[model samples]
Target: MKVELYDTTLRDGAQSEYISFTVKDKLRIAKKLDELGIHYIEGGFPGSNPKDAEFFSRVKEIEFDNSKIVAFGSTRHAKVKAEDDMNLRSLVDSGTDYVTIFGKSWDMHVRDALKILPEENLSMITDSIEYLREHGIKVFFDAEHFFDGYINNKEYAMKTLRAAEEAKASCLILCDTNGGALPFNILEVLNEVKGKIKTALGIHAHNDSDAGVANSVIAVRAGATQVHGTINGYGERCGNANLCSVIPNIKLKLHINCISDNQLKKLTEVSKLVAELANMSHLHNMPYVGRSAFAHKGGVHIDAVLKNPLTYEHIKPELVGNERRFLISDLSGKSNILAKAKELGLKLGKGSPEVKVILDQLKEMEKQGYQFEGAEASFELLLMRTLGLVKKFFVLDGFRIIVDTHYEELTSEGTIKVRVGNRYEHTAAEGNGPVNALDNALRKALEKFYPSLRDVYLTDYKVRVLDTTEGTGAKVRVLIESTDGKDSWSTVGVSENIIEASLKALIDSIEYKLHRTRGQ
Candidate 1:
């Protein structure tokens, strides 16, 4: 049987406390998910919130190629009948062809959370599904906490699925809600459930124990026709099962096709785009699309991959919209240096003296906490310096900005001091904020040294509080990424004072650009 992958990134993924998508973002994501060739896209909970409901009403106008938008909701409230339940009614009016409804399956949950008898819970499940089917909507029944429900009371869990089955649930999704079940135990239950249910079966897993991917794969091996997951595993608590990991695993490892070759090429781009829209940093070690997924640094590995990429990499990075990178770091060997040199159109043979010199400087600089992993342009500069390509750029004659705040007067004072070439200049600027004043003053100082610096603008600045203490002291890391329309580079600074870190990175960005300009 062909396996179907259902993506709940927008619906379940929004359960993540940090993620919230605008209506347009949801529509854009829905179209991207369809582009990935997912069988179903769970958009959001239609009746639960205004944002989700607005998204669902607007998503009807979107054009999709191969995916059906699935609206998610609970089965029904305890006192309300499925036909009269406002939640179920909202799902019907949302204009989606398919709907997913979750019902309590664990005995503890049904008894304590709902305070209802087991038979009434079964009736709720049957009625909710039947009502959707009666309205010509495809229904996928999610037996919430199904794995734990099966473990505690196998008969009741099996009976609960029977209720959904009799009511014509298009598919029965068994959820590892708490994500505590091991693979072996999951396989055992999957096998048992398969023997009992004649309808299609699916698996929805969470990553609480860090085994979401493992359990999902094992469930598929035992016979799950569908797998549910979110992009990059973004969801409530630990996370949902990572479709990024599972898709490649199912296609490459099991030798089965989960999605078309064309759809797979857009995987990495979509992954990063979702992270950008959500304003969350992408995990660099994520299985298929991470920055370091195919990065090589060690000498032995680099040599082997150069000969045959399959010797080190499982899949070609291009297959998933990613690329191989040769990282330069302390652990780098001769092969690593040569590869990096080759990228810059320079030739360096193994055991070359030039390579030795470059490697030595890299190690010494790194010892002082200079990081090049995210600063490729800076690393290239280091290589040029080692090759004696240093040309005279304007000297950084010292510069400083001072800010003063007085609560009694409710006024702040700012001043900037600097030396340009052979002359010293002082500038004063006032702004609503101290940082704004400092930026203005620094730019004033630099314009005298290089007129072109005026055309270069600070396009983006980011500040992150790195470490926090109990109510008082904290360390901040500031990353200032700037662009000159054609090129962009990032610089970093870390200090206890937020202002100091921002200043350090800001200065580095300006200095690095001047250095590059001098070469040109």
Candidate 2:
């Protein structure tokens, strides 16, 4: 069976909170979706904003391989002609052959939101679709709030579908605009639509009820030929359906072909790619395309998985371009340690004493509020140091921070002295804050010794209070992220003083960078 995949990452996804896709971001995602073999890519509402309008004009230059770029907008206004409707006119000017326009399907929406007669709403749907069709544009009619509309007034909702069908819409897309429909609700409505309508059907689902993927699959099972979704479920409110999960469920589980096997493997890659471009961290727990999706931390689970992957894994991690990961933590057992060591290219006997030492050290560190989950670089450094295989690079002699405030303007200065082998370098630098000042001073003292250290810079810094009951005297944990452009790593430090904790993490970050740059 074949199900068409339509991506709205550039359109509906931009409506997500804290997400504002620039023209370049939209263009980049559209190209990725096209390469992944999506049947349709909803670029954006053509005239919604200057940025979106410019996106439509700029998108025309890039040629798509397997996807059609689509313009999205709403139906004509209650009193306006489709020819003169600004939204409808923007659709024609968008320069795309396929266009998606939504119409109010719920009677409450017609009465409240549109403030028009239910009959007038139907005319708007017919007129907008027909006008686009007259210009040789294939229209995808989105029936907004459709599932709610069907339950409240089946007669009026069916009338709206009939309106679009009568207007020769290329596809009738039923949208769960509020995203509260369960599978049974969707199945019931789809069965009714199949019995009454002849036009091709598609489903646009949202994740408010957290069944976006399930409802989309149910719609496909009920013979809806098309599925609409965003890349990582990014959208207004909760989110739109996640194609990252929807596509895999439809292809691998349902045994349907929405995209080729090669394109399917791009799921994880594209998921993270879109997340990075959106300036959001990729969800580590998201199904199919997440970092932790196939990760095993339990010792028993790891042992069973190594014996037979089917024991703990539902599917091969490689199936979706994600690899299995064995996390090393206090809960890890001998099997976990061995497997993790093997992954890290550390040769160890089955019963090596070093393994127990590493495990014990890990547990002790955790007790002291050290979390290695997001600090893989720190974990590896600690592991090597525990194994007595690490080389000392530099030793910190002492460091001091001084702050002066005058007229409400504060200046922080950091002074540091470090011994590199037989030599010592002392440096001082002023900064906006104590952490920044220390970072500058340290780099100033080390750049001449290792110029590559100049390329290493802090990317993220996070602090957590471990013992909040102690209030001002609480121990704090600081996690610092550093990158040399091509690669990034995270390190953690814990102390009662925030500056001391930050300094510890900063020191680990530099050591990790030097260890990495030396190709060790």
Q: TM-score for each prediction?
A: 0.86, 0.96
Best by TM-score: 2
Q: How far in Å is the alpha carbon of 446 misplaced in model 1?
A: 5.1
> For residues 319-359, could you state the per-residue lDDT of candidate 2 as single tens digits?
88899998877787889878877888999876889988888
Best by lDDT: 2
Please list all clashing residue pairs in model 2, or write none if there are none: none
Backbone collisions counted per model: 0, 0
lDDT of each: 0.83, 0.91
Q: List the pairs of residues colliding in candidate 1.
A: none
